[model samples]
Target: MSDSSTAAEQTYRVVRNDEEQFSIWWAGRALPDGWYPEGTEGSRDECLARIAEVWTDMRPLSLRRRMEEATAG
Candidate 1:
């Protein structure tokens, strides 16, 4: 109902897992296992913007590596 509360609700952080997938997580909450912060924190839109900018490759890291290996051989 207040601007401050609304802003607080919008706060988020960018997180990534071992697979290198990008996602937004609520700030101040415990990150799930294997998920670590990607160091960008701000409103939901800001976090998502960062993800869009950096996560151009949608493939998971392991999958990409395997695909490269298969091609190289």
Candidate 2:
């Protein structure tokens, strides 16, 4: 369960088009809603970090609760 659940909770990624249009995907599935960065003026790493921050903000409470349960289990 740990191994498989960890696999399921792995990081998701955002892919952008040449036009800056993009979509979100998680665990091989497309996220229902699309997303785009709202700020500018940074290095590539900074941009990626911002994306990560957004991802964390959108993380599911179900995942967090499951992780806590896994740890407690």
Candidate 3:
């Protein structure tokens, strides 16, 4: 296979953080400081679909926490 095709075929995985944010990460690369793998590794499209299905709420964890605190206080 050609070098360009090989590069284009890189794999990815779905990742999420404490704030409930989602992102796609390269399959073999080290995850960043706060992010961790949320689901199986696959093509970028597959990971994005998984995030869309589960990440129904768009707010980050901090925002959700503040909203809850305001409502309670």
Candidate with maximal TM-score: 1
Residue ranges of candidate 1 with Cα displaced over 4 Å: 2-9
| Candidate 3, 17-73: lDDT as tens digits | 999999999998999999999966887678788888989999999999999999999
Residue pairs with backbone atoms closer than 3 Å in model 3 (clashes): none
For residue 51, model 3's alpha carbon misses the true position, in angstroms, by 0.7
lDDT (C-alpha) at residue 31 in model 2: 40
Q: Which structure is stronger by TM-score: 1 or 3?
A: 1
What residue runs in model 2 are displaced by over 4 Å at the alpha carbon?
A: 1-37, 57-73
Residue pairs with colliding backbones in model 1 are none
Q: After the best TM-score superposition of candidate 1, give how far the Cα of residue 32 lies from its true spot, in angstroms.
A: 0.8
What's model 2's TM-score? 0.27
Best by lDDT: 1
Question: Each model's TM-score?
Answer: 0.87, 0.27, 0.82
Alpha carbon lDDT of residue 40, candidate 3?
69
Query: Cα miss at 17, model 1 (Å)?
Result: 0.4
